[model samples]
Target: MSTTTETLKSQWEALKAENPHMRIRNAAEKLGVSEAELVATSIGEGVTRLRPEFAAILTEVEKLSKVMALTRNDECVHERKGVYLNPDFSSPHAGLFVGEDIDLRIFLSAWDKAYAVVEKGEDRDKKSLQFFGKDGLAIHKIYTTRDSNDAAFDVIVEQFKSDNQSNEETTVAVPLDIDEKPDSEIDVDGFKAAWIDLKDTHEFFGMLRKFGVTRTQALRLAPSEEHAHKIEKDAIVKMLEGAAAQKLPIMCFVGNRGNIQIHTGLVRKTMWHNNWFNVMDPDFNLHLDMDKIAQTWIVRKPTEDGVVTAIEVFNEMGEIIVQFFGKRKPGIPELTEWRELVASL
Candidate 1:
């Protein structure tokens, strides 16, 4: 190893000795390096660097059986427990995981660094596969549960292990821009006309790109109050409570640049603690930074079934933190209770 890398490794070790509970992400920040770099230091010690063949790795992930899939951004963290199955990698840059319990939209381009980590616990070793973006931020992670196939995990880890095991310092580029356009410059008339002509909810992203406006900007200039109305910041908590009370099944979508993790079911427990709103359940957990939510909107989109409504929350950066929708299939109409619940907000 080079002198600088050796020094970083030593510093990381010393920091771990000082506080063994310090997370690797926090430790990387403390040492002024990327989390990938910090993890690379322990390549041979319970950690193995994997080749950046994300699709193949995901295919192999199916063998691990039951595991927890985790995806997070700066303001939201989503975790779901299930098996990884039916991964469609037809597009090199984009992929899909269409499992009943674990649903994910994968953007493979953002995923650059991959690693298989084996952490020693009090009783046994905890194994995981972690993926990072070009900026060295975590994109997605899969953790092996107690019921996971340990033999399958070991085989895949050994198969995909990288030959180059050097503990070298690495540099990361600045995060990608969101391609946002100023609201003042956007042609409001054209944007409104296109918004009104929308046929499917999936076309929303293309509409934004066509009008050169950000999602938040489109919400602001949505032509009519019925189409998009601003809501109280605490509306999320209200919606969650309402869902729980009515026993309404809902879909929660939380994602970063590289992946979108979804939880579709009934959320029984809604919790608030330390300025965070959380959905704490047995199979899924959602942690949202309530303080970071600068705006909340009730957005209506026309689908073939009917006009579907959603509760969309945005962070201070105008990026979506989390979105909530009434659980309904593509052919089914929106639930009347859900619409009423959102309207009550």
Candidate 2:
């Protein structure tokens, strides 16, 4: 090991010894390094650096049977337990793992480094496969469950293990800054017309790009209150509680720049811890920091079947934190109960 890496390892060990409860991401922030960098410090110590055939590795994850897929951003963490199913890697730019229990939207181009980790717990060893982006931010993670196929996980780890095990730093890239056009410069009439004439909810992203308007900006100019209206931040709590109370199946989407993890089912349990609002279900868990929610909008979009409704939350910086939707598929209209629930809000 180089002198620098050795020094970092010692420092990290010391920090962990000081506070065993500090999460790796928080520790990395405190140590002034990327989370990937800190994980790389333990390269050969129960941590195997994996070759960057990300898509291929994902295809094999289904063999693990039951595992927990985790994806997070600054304000939200999404965890869903199920088998990785129906991987569509046909697109070079992105990928999809579509299933009833586990659904994911993977952006292949954002992935950079990967590692298979085995951490010693009080009773048994915890194993996981973690992927990071070019910016050293986590893109996605797959962890072995109590019922997971450990043998399959080990096989995958060995199959994709990289020859390089050096505890070297991850090459960090600067984040891109895409400037949005000023609201005054945007064609308000054209944008409003397009929004009202939308055919599908999926076209919303394209519409934003076509007009060079930011997501929040578009929400602000959403034609009228019927289309989009801001609600109190704590509306998330009510939404979750209401869905759970009525046995309503809802969809929760949490994502960052690289991946969007989704949970599509009923949320039964919910609670508040400090400022965090959480859904503590058996197969899925959603942790959302309510304090970070700057704006929560009840948005309505036109679809072929009918109008689709969503509750979208955004952070202070105007970046999306999480989105909630009624459980419905293409060609199916939004649930009347869901609309009534939103109306109640």
How many steric overlaps are in each model, in order?
Answer: 0, 0
Q: What is the model-wide C-alpha lDDT for candidate 1? A: 0.89
List TM-scores for all candidates, in order.
Answer: 0.95, 0.98
The 0-to-1 C-alpha lDDT of every candidate, in the order given, reads 0.89, 0.91
Against the true structure, candidate 1 reaches a TM-score of 0.95
Candidate that scores best on lDDT = 2
Model 1 spans with C-alpha error above 4 angstroms: 17-21
For candidate 2, write residues 76-145 as lDDT tens digits: 9999999999999998767999999889989988889999999998987899999998777788999999
True lDDT of residue 163, candidate 2: 91
Q: In candidate 1, what are the lDDT values of residues 115-195, reduced to their tens digit? A: 999999898789999999877888999999998998999998888888877777366786656677767788999999888
RMSD for each of the candidates: 1.7, 1.1
